[model samples]
Target: MNINVERQKMADRLFLVAVEGEIDVYTAPVLKKELLPLTEISGTGVTLDLSRTVYIDSTALGVIIAALKSAARNRCRFSVVGMSPRVERLFTITGLMEILRREKIAEGDN
Candidate 1:
């Protein structure tokens, strides 16, 4: 299936982008579109809520990584929250978790 993207302004500088459904090749661009611009703004804290997301392909993963990198470069905070067990395993086994751990981005998960 496609995806649904919902954005929320949590604070003056904190934005929450909640993605539901599947994030695959076709839908990854949508996720990127919603995410990259937020990272471009300096000091913007972007939290990606994936609680409702059930599936994500490699393209989507790459988009997420790129967003995180952009957030790091722009000095904006980026973190992911409420990942499902399957998706969480993908992040862990692919070493993306290590990359996230090493990067000085994203604040508390809460």
Candidate 2:
């Protein structure tokens, strides 16, 4: 799995993390390590772009949910973006789309 991080500075910090490959039990920890910290900063906005992510398992989903909760606690803005069709379906089926505030972008656009 590959994770790329970008940060934008303004009145509030914006963190954009792009992921490629599968997010499973093995890779979830890596992603969690990279994302969890951003949730600690108040007014920090996090956008997790999964445009290239091929697959995601339950563990990864749990990690993402945890990140969202942390962001809420810290008053950060968290959003999930660019989910592939299959991943988007998974979120839809699990009723996580609304809770996660996920955004679906065209496959090639991101």
Query: What is the clash count for each candidate, in the order shown?
Result: 0, 0
Q: Which ten residues in a row have the lowest lDDT in candidate 1?
A: 101-110
Report the C-alpha lDDT of model 2 over 1-110, residue by residue, as the tens digit: 55444444434488777777888888888888888898888988888888878999999889888888898899988878788879988887887875654433123322
Candidates in order have lDDT scores of 0.86, 0.76
TM-score on alpha carbons, each prediction: 0.91, 0.81
lDDT, candidate 1, at 23: 98
Candidate 2 residue spans exceeding 4 A from truth: 1-12, 101-110
The window of 10 residues in a row where model 2 has the poorest summed lDDT is 101-110
Q: Write the per-residue lDDT of candidate 1 for residues 54-82, one digit (tens) a residue.
A: 99989989998999879879999899887
* Number of the top-ranking candidate, with lDDT as the measure: 1
